[model samples]
Target: MYYTIGEVANATGIAISTLRYYDREGMFPDMERSSGGIRVFSDKELGTLKVVECLKHAGMSIKDIKEFLGWCQEGDATLPQRRRMFHDRLAEVERQMDELRNTMNLLRYKCWYYDTAVAAGTEDAVRDLPDEDVPEDLRDYRI
Candidate 1:
């Protein structure tokens, strides 16, 4: 079924402005316009937007997603490129997950340290640290 831009935005929880921006970026070249020239979206277009949301949630840049769409439009000629993109994104996601796990461990350790210091009445043992002491593994996990 077809849907208006507003409807699609409401259903997907994506801002209508962002959907329009994606359309302008050639992510949905087959998108139709209504008789009054408002954007009209097909189910396929909505599906594409959902994929875009997933990619964004995975920390992908708009440029990378645009390139992916370009390769998608070129069909089999860019299948290898598409595969490589997917592989890269997968590797990045795995690294992010590892870092998050490490960070959680560090935070737990820090909390335990603080609790023990308080219980033992030994503030010096709390080991005040610069934020940088958070290991390299978790440094780049900022949201």
Candidate 2:
């Protein structure tokens, strides 16, 4: 079934203007237009929009995404290049995940620090605790 641009926007949770900009940027190369110049989107196009959203969330630049879309249009001949692109993206994502995990660990340590301080009614009390009493994962963060 075909959907109007407004319908596509509602379904995808993307702003209508952004979707229009994507169309203008050649992100929707296979999109159809009515004789009267209205854009027509198919259900299949919704899946394409989901991929665009995922790639954008993964930190791909619009120009790079456009290039990837162009590669997509080239069919199986571009499979190796597309695989490498995804592999590179995967590496970046893994690096981001590692950074986030480190941040989370620090946050957890701070939470424990504050909680201990609250229990003792003074930050100094928690700060005086021995290193052996600290969680191993948080030992490096000890006061």
Candidate 3:
């Protein structure tokens, strides 16, 4: 269905100005325009914007996304390049996942430490706990 720029922004939860900037940047290659210069969007273009948002969330720079969009416009000849980009992004996401997991582990240990201190009515009580009594997962995070 045809939609105005405002409708697209509301549907996608992106600012109208940002959508206009993206249009200015040629991110929406197939977007149409009225004779008076108003931007028009279609459902397909909205889907494309959603993908652009996802790539931005995945840490891709606008320049890189523009380049990727260029490759897309180039069609089948750029398939391998697009595949490599996705593969590299996947590896980076995996690294971020590992870091997040480590952070979560540390936070969990801190929660347990504070909970024990609360139960015993003193931080010193938690600090004085025997090493063998500590959780195995939190051993490395022990003070």
Quote each prediction's TM-score.
0.78, 0.91, 0.92
Q: In candidate 1, what are the lDDT values of residues 22-94, reduced to their tens digit?
A: 9999999889898899988998897888888888888999998998888888899999998988888889999
- lDDT: worst 10-residue window of model 2: 134-143
Candidate 3: the clashing residue pairs are: none
Writing each residue's lDDT as its tens digit, candidate 2 over 1-143 gives: 99999998887789999999999998888899999999999876787888889999899999999999999999999999999999999999999999999888888889999998899899988777888888888987654
Model 2, runs deviating above 4 Å = 140-143
Better of 1 and 2 by TM-score: 2
Stretches of candidate 1 above 4 Å error?
119-143
Q: Give the Cα error of residue 118 in candidate 2, in Å.
A: 2.0
Q: What is candidate 3's CA lDDT for residue 101? A: 91
Against the unseen true structure, what C-alpha lDDT does each candidate score? 0.81, 0.90, 0.89
lDDT of 2 at 65: 91
